[model samples]
Target: ILHPISVLEEEDDEAVIEKYSGSCLAGVSPKLPPLPPKILVEKVAPAPVLLSMEDEEVVRAVVSGSIPSYSLE
Candidate 1:
């Protein structure tokens, strides 16, 4: 969203620079709308738990290509 005037000025293209150089000669630029408000978030921690022997067996089976690994619950 950069003004073409700024870019042309940087490139030193003075030929077309005179056209956009005047603001008071043309008219005032329109004001842009304000941005949305910032959102606040709270940190969360997962519950602590231990995996059963069956769970371990399922993991091993999946690793060994005996079963496909997917969500259990």
Candidate 2:
């Protein structure tokens, strides 16, 4: 389910940019899935280690009290 670019601002836009490379959606800025960073940590365990520290940090918020609420359908 592709979303309009406006949805990108609802979440971290960098995920699309970070995950885009080496993915099938190369050259495209796809919408970031509106999952919170906790879910990201769940998936990140088995994810590729090639991601940079910044990218890894993007998967988790810098502070626990700061986890942004993800907009769910």
Candidate 3:
């Protein structure tokens, strides 16, 4: 006994279906705007020294308020 071989026919619409499917289905994220230009900073002078309270003066100021208060403002 001999068996007949069966062949499947390829659809003409397969190419069209593949062309419209899968990877292309996802939406692309919008491109972000370019960042602002970098600012050029000049060399700044060292900060000025404020009050220099001695340990004794600090103690006297806190205990008796005899020393003038140092303003941080």
Q: Which candidate is the best by lDDT?
A: 1
lDDT of each: 0.69, 0.56, 0.61
- The local lDDT score (0 to 100) that residue 24 gets in candidate 2 is 53
Q: How much does each candidate deviate from the true structure in C-alpha RMSD? A: 9.9, 29.5, 15.0
Candidates ranked, most accurate by lDDT first: 1, 3, 2
Order of the predicted models by TM-score, top scorer first: 1, 3, 2
Write down the TM-score of every candidate.
0.36, 0.21, 0.29
- How well is each residue in 1-73 modelled by candidate 1, as lDDT tens digits? 2344545444556755665565443455778999999898886888887889998898888899888666544
lDDT of 3 by residue, 1-73 (tens): 2233333366456664565455452476888999999999998999976665686567667678665566422
Model 2 gets an lDDT of 0.56
Residue 65 lDDT, candidate 3, scale 0-100: 64
Better of 2 and 3 by lDDT: 3
- Candidate no. 1 TM-score: 0.36
